[model samples]
Target: MRYDVNLSILFTELPMLERPAAAARAGFDAVEMWWPFDGPTPADAELDRLAGAVTEAGVQLVGLNFDGGHMPSGDRGLLSSPATSRRFRDNIDVAVGFAERLGCRTLNALYGNRTDDTDPELALENLALAAKAAGGVGATVVVEALNSFENTRYPITSSAQAFQLLDQVPGTAFLADFYHLGRMGEDLSALIANHADRFGHVQIADVPGRGQPGTGELDYAAILRQLADSPYDGHVGLEYKPVGPSEESFSWLEAMP
Candidate 1:
């Protein structure tokens, strides 16, 4: 199974631009990250600096997230936020352009938490816009579900919930984030077998702690074995938060069957 490190989570001990090299040093050849700036559109030089760091590290950027507003502040994303619709629209082409430049083909668009103002029709429209923008540059736009316990306001929290969006918007793909799904007590193996065809980009973090695999209850070896046998063939993103120093958290990688 080919794996790509999520630089945004894995190498936080280092500077943002420095994480790519750190990931490379830890033996990863491909990496992914959330938008690398506080704003949707950063200065050209800032983008240049990040691109240079990735290129210099000799790693392929395989996946990227559309600019979701400040995540730590509990803003899940702008895709379906009525108050932030303009910001989400303004970010689509810019994100797609950067992804094309980095040879990345998968772009994840996080669905915002459901608010009193949430509009289902507006959300579908934004998702369609994102799908079209990414298609223009030969990239696929992926939608992901988050667990409700922590993301209490986020609407799409189950594999079935995320898969339902695929029918509403053609060309929209599903991002199966195992951590969130697992935390919700979903039958992962059964879901993998059933929805294998819709899997676009997959991410994993052991639940109960959101740490690397093997640190929590998930049997990654068995899960991975099943994933390897499934029809879905895409990079399994290591998107877990580490227990300690990020570099030291990869022992599971070598031990995985």
Candidate 2:
């Protein structure tokens, strides 16, 4: 099982490329990001620079969040916003270019929930269109469902609902976060096994606090064993906030199968 570090938490203390190197130094094989495409609009040259960092650090940019909704002050990212529809498409085109440069093949398109009168069908249509746009660059798009308790605006919650959305879209898939799935009242192992076919990327965090593994109530070892037994082959993105120092929180990496 390869591990990835999301640079959202530690980018300030280390260089972008050094984030992966830090994880590698701690015995991880890969790294990821929430959204590394946020700089003066989006461009391939910038992404190529990021790719260069990853190559220089000898770590893979396994996954990235193409949507930019998590910014403060509650602005929904693309795939769900009408005002930024064209802008979002343009951003995704730029992201694809960056993905190619980094050799990253999987992208998490977290569509922010709309609180307006926009019909659900319209949202699905926009999401499908965005997925098609991502597929054009040979990158598989995985629509992730965030827990409403933590992110009250995130729309898709249940695994079944995420799968249903994927069913609606032709070339899209579902990303299952154990922390979110458990928060939304789904059995982790059962959900993982049942949707094994549709699972693209998996993230883990302990319950109640979203901390590192072994700090909370998540049975990560069991989950990893089950994933190892399944046909699913993907990298597990670390999307939790570190309770203390970043490296200290990940000592449990030695415990994952």
Candidate 3:
């Protein structure tokens, strides 16, 4: 069971450009992230700099999310919104190109918050479109399920819901985030046992407060052991918020069995 630190959440005290090296120095050899720019389209110079940072750090860029609206302001995603479909389409090439440059194979497509004005069919159509574009570059699209408590407007709140959308997009797979499912009171063990083959990637954070593994009630060692025994071979992304300094928060890594 290998692990990758999510730079978007951990080591966030540093500038975005410096986080990859910071994570590498902290003994992480791989990293993942949400859209690193303020918008779907960023200047080529900015893109090159970020790609250079990851390369200079010598870490594998594993997973990345397509533009998920304003993450800091809690916009879950843009794909599900009719208004943002154009932006989502525009971002496909940019996101795929960046991933290809970094040798990243898994691209997460967050299902945006549901709106009365947005037709579900349109959202599905856009997701399939994104999948087709990413597939052309030999990358897989991943659909994630968010917790209802924090993401009330985001409709895909369960493994069942995520799979439904995944079915619509042929090459897409489900991103099983234990933290979100556990926070929603879903059976993590059962989910892993039943759908491990369908998971393209996995992310972890402890429940209750979304902190490091030990800071909450999740039995990660047991969960990881299950993953190891199962068919899921993807890296487990450490997506938790540190309770203290990010470096100090890594004691749980050494403690993982």
For each candidate in turn, the TM-score is 0.98, 0.90, 0.98
Worst 10 residues of 1 by lDDT: 248-257
lDDT of candidate 1 at residue 127, scale 0 to 100: 91
Residues 81-171, candidate 2: write the lDDT tens digits: 6665666666666666677777788877767666674456656776776677777878788877777786786677888778878888888
Name the lDDT of candidate 2. 0.74
**What are the per-residue Cα lDDT tens digits for candidate 3 across 1-257?**
88999999999999989999999999999999999998899999999999999999999999999998888788888887778888889898999999999999999998788787767888889888988988998999999899999988889899998998888779999999999999999999999999999999999999989999988999988888899999999899999999999878888877675
Rank all candidate structures by their TM-score, best first, as comma-separated numbers.
Answer: 3, 1, 2
Judged by lDDT relative to the true structure, which candidate is superior, 1 or 2?
1
Candidate 2 local Cα displacement, residue 226, angstroms: 1.1
RMSD, one per candidate, in order: 0.9, 2.1, 0.8
Model 1's alpha-carbon lDDT is: 0.90
Can you tell me which runs of candidate 3 are displaced by over 4 Å? none
Cα TM-score of candidate 3: 0.98
